[model samples]
Target: MNRLFNLVNQQDNRQLLMNTIRNGRVANAYLFHGPEGSGQEGFALEYAAMLNCQSRENQPCGQCPSCHKMKTLEHGNIHLVFPIRTGSLEKNDPPFKNFGPDDMEEIQNCIRKKAENPYEKLCPFDGKHIPINFIREIRRKIYLTAPEPGYKVVIVFDADLMMEPAANAFLKILEEPPDKTLLILTTSNIDAILPTIRSRCQRLHFPALSTTDLGNHLRENGIREDRINLVMRLSGGDVRQAIQLKEADLGRLREMTLEALRMIAIWKIDKVYDLVNRFVTLRKENPDEFDRLMLSISFWFRDAAILKAGKPESDLVHADMQIEIRKFVDYYTELDAFGAYSAVDNCIDLISRNVYINLALVNMFFKIHNRIQPGKSQ
Candidate 1:
C-alpha cells in the first residue's frame, strides 16, 4: 500500500487531495478539522511529502529524499508548530512568562514522539496558550523561499490553542501568504479558531474512524482480543483513547463501576452517597483515574441498554459480564435503559464542564435509580 493511504482510512479524502495534486491546483491554506487521533497530522505530513516528492508518480514515493526527510520531520522546507509551555513546571501549575531550557527539552521530546507515532497525543502544557512570539517567528519563516525550490509547508498542530494575539497575527499571513507557501492548520476544536483565519482556509472535515478500523489498528499493535473489543466499544472510534485505555487499570475501574451500579440497583441511598463521596475524593487526588471511572460507568450503562434492546451479546462492551448486564436489563424497559444512558451521558458532560463531582455523580445515581424502578416513568 502507498505510505500516505496507509496512514488514514478516509479514501475519499485521499482521492480529493490526490486529484488536486495531479491537477496542480493545491490550495494555499487548508484546515484539517477532526477529532484527535483521526490521523490529521499524519495526513498533513504525507500531503506535504507528496507536494514536494521528486517522483514520477503523484503519490509520495517513500524512496524519494523528500519523503525520507518528511518521515523524520527534518525537511528544511517544512515547518512544524504546536502548543508549548513558556516555562518549566508541573502540568497543573500556573503558566509562566519565560521559556526555559526544561520547557524546550519537553517540547523537543513531544515532537520526537509525534515523529514516531502520529496518533500519539502531545504532552499538554495546561493553562498555557500558543504565544504571539511563535506566530511572529512563523511569519518570518514563511516569507523565506524554500531552500530546495519547491513548496514551503507550515503545519500548525492544535491551532485552536492560539491566543487572541497569536491568532490575529496569523491572520496577516493568511490574508497574503507568500507565493508557493502552503499553510495547514489542524484543530480538534474548530470553533476555538478565529473566523477570519477559518474563512481563509479550505476546510476538510474528518469523521471519526469506524470501529473496524480502530479494531484493526489495535490488533495490529498487538492488543489482546478481549482488550481490543472493550477498547473498541469504549473509544467511540477514537484510536488514541483506545490505546490509552488499554494501558489503564481497567479491572479496577470496572469493579468500581459495578459497585456503584449495585448500589443504585439495590436502592441503597446511603451506599450510593458513600460511593459518590469516594468518587469525589478520587477526583481530587487523581483526576485521570476519576475520568476512567466515569467512562467505565458510562460503558456499563451502554451495555445495559444493548441488553435491554435485545441486541446480540457480541455487541456489548462488557460482554464478559453478560450475566450481570442481563440481570440489570431485566429491571428496566428499553426506554428506561435509554434514559439511564442519557443520564450518564449528561453527567459525563457536566463533569467535563467542571461541575462539582459529588453533585454530578450523586445526581446521576438518583436519576439512574429512578429509571431502574418498576412502574416509574423516566
Candidate 2:
C-alpha cells in the first residue's frame, strides 16, 4: 500500500523508515514511542508492509499478493500481539475459547478496523491495559516458523498498556527472540512501560506534526479553510485527530462546552453536579471518549484564559472554541479564567496518574467554584 501518503505530515520519520527499509537493515525489535494520535501505529504497519511486500517500491506494493494479504491482515508472516481482557475468562470467549479460527477471525477483524480507522469508534476492548493471556498466545506464535522466506514480523500496538505479567512473560522472548523474528511495539505512554522491555528494543520517538504540515494534511483531506483552526486546535498537531475533527460537527462541541461553562460561571452547584452526572454517563458508555471530552473542556478553559489575558488565540490550544470563549469574557475575569484552567489541568494530571474519575470530576468542580472569586489564586 502507498501508506507513505497516510503519514500525513510525518515526512522526517517517513524518510527515516524508508532509508532503513532501503538498506534492509531493519531492527529485531523497535519501540515507537509518542503521544497518542500521532500515527505511530500506522507508521509501524506501513513499515511492516514495506518490509514484507514482494514487489518492493519506496512504499509497499498494495497490489502484490503479499501486500494484498497484509492489507487484509491475512499475511501469515505478519503477526500481532496485543492485550486481551479476561475479566471473567470462561471456555466461551471464542478466541478465549480455543484460540480457534473463529476467534482469530474476530481478532483480525478488530485489528483491521483499528488499523483502518484508529480515530473512529473505540474498539470493544479495554484501552487502559493489555491483558496477560495475549502475551502467552504471542509466545506460541513466535515459536511457529514463518510461512514465507523472509522475516516474521510481530507488531504490538499500545505496548505500554501491557500488564506486568505480560511484560515479564514477553521478556524471555525478547532476551532470545527467534532468528527470523522482527518485533515492533508502539506506545504513547513509554514511561509507563517496564524498563526491562524498553532495554530490549530500539527506541524511536515520534514527534508531533508541525502546524504547516497539519494544515496541509487537513486541506488534502478535504477540510474547509474556516474549520481548519478548529481541527488544528483540537488535534494538537496530530493528523489522525485532525481527520476526525474534519468529519465531526463543531456545533455539538460548542453546545457541550456552553452547557459546562454555564454551570461553572454561574456557580450552580446542583447544575454542576448534573453536568458531571452527564459526564459519568458518557464515561460509562465509552471511557475513552469521556477522556477526550475532558480534554476538550480543559483546552477550552485554557483558551478562555489566554483570550482573557489579551494574548494571541494561537497561544491557546483550543482556538476553535473562540465563539464559546467570547461568551465567558462577559461573565469571567482573567483571574476567574485562570482558576478554571488550573482546575482542569489538575484534573487531567490526576486522571493521567490513575486517580478515580468520579472523585476527580467532583474535586475539580469544587476547586473551580471556590477559586472563581476575583482575587483567588487556586
The lDDT leader among the candidates is 1
Q: Mind giving the per-residue lDDT tens digits that candidate 1 earns over 313-374?
A: 77777766778777667655433777888898899899889898788888898898877775
lDDT of residue 14 for candidate 1: 78
Off by over 4 Å in 2: 1-5, 87-95, 98-106, 118-124, 127-136, 139-145, 163-165, 222-227, 230-242, 245-249, 263-336, 343-378
Q: Which stretches of candidate 1 lie over 4 Å from their true place?
A: 4-6, 86-97, 227-229, 262-273, 285-288, 308-310, 323-343, 349-355, 366-378
Per-residue CA lDDT of model 2 for 117-195, tens digit only, reads 6433223354456666666777777788778766688888778777787788778879888987888998888988789
Superposed on all Cα atoms, model 2 deviates from the true structure by an RMSD in Å of 5.2
Q: Model 1 residue 350 lDDT?
A: 94
Q: Name the candidate that leads on TM-score.
A: 1
TM-score of every model versus the real structure? 0.82, 0.74
